[model samples]
Target: MPNKHPYTTLISAANLLPNAQLENWVIIDCRHDLSAPEAGRAAYDAGHIPGARFAHLDHDLSGTKQAAAGGFKGRHPLPEQDALIATLRHLGINDDTQVVAYDAHGGMYAARLWWLLRSIGHASIAVLDGGLAAWEALGQTLSTEAPTSAEGNICAKPTLVASVDADDVLKNLTNPQRTLVDARAPDRFRGENETIDPVGGHIPGAKNRFFKDNLQADGRFKPGHQLHEEFSNIISASQTAVMQCGSGVTACHNLLALEIAGLHGAALYPGSWSEWCADAGRPVATGA
Candidate 1:
C-alpha cells in the first residue's frame, strides 16, 4: 500500500514575504515552453522572484528521454527517484520547509512539483494560488539574483510514494475502485488533433474531462461543489483515481483541479499515454 501524503491548502503571495521565506520556506519557479526548451531557464537567469529557485519542466522536473507512448512521446518523462531527491536537495529543501511552487502562466507546471512532492510522502508544499502571474499582480517584489540551495535533512521515504505501472493500468480495466482521466483538450482526446503526438487517441478505458473544464473563465479553479459534480459525472468519488495527459505535464492540471475540488487522494500517470503508446502493445481508443 502506498503511504498517504499530507498537503497544505490555500497559500497566497502575502504568505511568502521575505521574513517568512527566511523561516525555512522553499520557493521554486516552474516555467517552460514546449517548443523552446532553453527559454524557461534563460528567462529565469534574467529575473525571478527573490530567493526563488528554478524548476525547469523539460530538464529538472522530467526525465531526459520520452518513451514511445502517445503522451510524453519524446518530450518529457518523470525523473527517477534518486535523481528527483538530488534535484530537491539542489534546491535546498528540508523536512520543515514550507515549499511553494509557481510558474509564469499558471500552476500547470507548478502542480507537477506539488504532485511529485506528495508522491514522495512529503506534502508541506502548495502551488501559488494564481502562480507568478498573480503574485506579480499583487505588487510583490522581484530580483535578478538567484538563491543558493540549502543542505538539509530532507530524505525521501520511498514507501510513501504511490505509482501506477502498465500492469496496474491493465488490471484496472474493470476495477470499480479505479478511474482514469485524460486531461487534454476535447479535440485531442477525440483524435481530431494530432499536432503533438504521432498517434491521435487515448487509453481505451479512459474518459475525457479536459483539464480546462475544471477552470472558470477567470482562469481560476471552479467552486469545490461544482468540481465535485464534474468529477462525479465521469468517475465515482469512493474509488481511487489516476490522471494523465500529453507527456504527463497537463495531467498535473487535472490533479490540481481534483485537489482544489477537495476530492483528495489520487495518483498521476507520470508517463501518461506517451509511455503507454511507446509499447505499441497497449490498447488505445480514438474518435468520439
Candidate 2:
C-alpha cells in the first residue's frame, strides 16, 4: 500500500503538537495565486501553521516552462517523474509517512499535491480538511520561522496510477469506461462566463460539479454520505471518473471532493482546458 489513498483529517490547534505518532506525518503549506506568484512565499515568510513546509505552485510543484513535446503545458503540467521523485525525497516523504497538504482558503492547490502523490503511485497522502483557514479558525498558533528539514531522505516510489492526456481524452470522447467531470463553476461550464481561460463552455459530454458545491457554508466538505448521494447522480458508484478545471488547478478540488465522497480511482487532467486550447487541433465546445 505504498501509494494507497489516505483519509483527510483536521488537526486541532491543541493536537498539532509534535509527538512520536505524528512525527512521521509531513505537513505542507500550499498557498498560491496565479496573479501574484510571490504571494505564497511571502505569506509563508510572514506566518504559517507550525511544522509546515512551503510548497510553492510555480517553484516546488510544477515545471517552469512547457515541454517541447510530451511535457508540461499551459498553466501547470505533470512534472517529469524523476524530478518529482526528487521533490518528495527532499520533503522527507517516504512510503509510510502520512502526508497532509493545505492551502490558505481551502485545499485548492493543496489538492494538487494529493493528486500528484497518488498519481505517482503513493497513496499515503491527503489534503487537510478546511485547510489553513479551519486551523486558524480554531485559534491555532502560527510561525514565521520555517521548520527544520528532516535529516532522513525519502525513497521514491512512482506508481503512475491515474491520468488522461489530451489524446487520451480525445479517444475517450465516446468511451464509456470514463466520464469527464469539470470542476469549474456552472456559469463558466455553460459558457456564460469566460474570464479565466480563453475558451468557454466545456468538453462535449462532460458534467459540471463546482467543487464548491461539496463544501458546507462553514467551508468544510459535506459529510461523506451526502457526497456519495450528490456524486451518484452524475457518476456511478463503480467508476472513479476524470476531473478537470481552469488550467488544472481547481480540478484538484473535484478530485479532493471525490476522495471525501469515498470515490477513489479518479484521474486528474492537470493541463485541462488551458493546455487543451494550447493545441489548436483539439476541439472546443461553447455554451451551456
Candidate 3:
C-alpha cells in the first residue's frame, strides 16, 4: 500500500534504482552527524548515489539561531520560507519532480526533507527506505561525479501539513483532544540523557516513541499494517497527535512513519524539546 504512488511517503531502494538516471528525478543525500557538522558533505564528496546532491542539516535544512534570543527557536530552526524556497529552486526541483532523500543513519534526516516538501505543498517527495546503507547493500554503484542541473522554477505554495508552536503545546496539555508524541530515545525522554540540550525531560504530556522503533532490524520502516497497529496502540485513531524530537530533526522520522502507517493528520512540533526547554516556566516531565 505504501508503494501505491510514485510520490508516496516511502520508496524502496530497488524501486529507486531504475528511475535514478531520469532527468525529472532529483536524489538528495541528507547524511549528517549533529556532533560533526562537516561529516555529511565529506561523505557525499567521497561517494554518493549517482546524480545525488548533498543537503547539509545545518547549512541547507536549518535557519539561523539568534544568540540574543538565547536560542529560543532551538538549535536547528526551520529556515525562513523564502530562503528554503530559493535552496529548492537552486537544487533544480520543480513541481513535478520526483525527489528521493536518503541518509546513512536510517531515514532520520531524509524524512525532514520529505516533510518539508510536503509542508510546502510539494507532494512529489519520498524518503529512501533504509537510506544509504540499503543502496550499498543491494550491490548498487556509487558515483563521485556530480551533475550540474539547470535552475528550476519551483515555487512554494500554501503549506499543507500542520505545525504546532509552544503555546499550542501548552494548551494541548489540558485539551484532551490532542496527544504529544516524542521521537527522542527513552533515556532522553526520562531526563537521564542530557547530551544535546542543557535541560533534560520532555513536554509534560508527551509519550516516547524513540524514532528508531519505526524501523525494523534492518533500518527500513516497518510494514504499513504493523506501523498502523503500533501507533494505534499509543495514540487513538480519533485523537490528533503532534510529533517532536530533541531539536525537531528526528521528529520527522516519526511523522514519516505515521504516514507510512496510514495514520495521517499528525502535526509537527518544530521547536520540540530544545525550544520547549528554553523557557524555564514551561512544564517538563521526567521518567517514563
TM-score of each: 0.87, 0.88, 0.95
What's the residue-level lDDT of 2 in candidate 2?
Answer: 39
User: Model 2, range 1-288, lDDT digits (tens) per residue?
Assistant: 232444443333334434212667778889988888999989988888777888888877886557866654767777777777778777878767778788876677887887778766666676767777777777676889887766435555566457777778888876656788888889888887677777777877788888888778877778878988898888874255888887777888777777667787778777787787666677778766
Clashing residue pair totals per candidate (backbone < 3 A): 11, 5, 0
TM-score: the better of candidates 1 and 2: 2
User: lDDT of each model, Cα atoms only?
Assistant: 0.74, 0.74, 0.87
lDDT of 1 by residue, 1-288 (tens): 111332354366666554346647778889777778888788888878888899888778887674445344335677877788888888888776678888776577888888777767676888777667667777876788987765756778653335576678877876645788889888888877678877788888788888778767755567778988888787786138888887788887777777777777677777777777777777789886
| Winner on lDDT (2 vs 3) | 3
Model 1 worst lDDT window (10 residues):
1-10
Candidate 3 lDDT, 1-288, residue by residue in tens: 122356668888999999898888899999999999999999999999989988989988988875445657888888888888888988888877889999999899999999888878888899999998899988998999877999977788777688888899988778756888999999999999689998999899788899999999999999989989999988885238889998889999988888888888888889899999999999998999
Give the TM-score comparing model 2 with the true structure, all chains together. 0.88
lDDT of 1: 0.74
**What is the alpha-carbon lDDT for the whole of candidate 3?**
0.87
TM-score of model 3 vs. true structure = 0.95
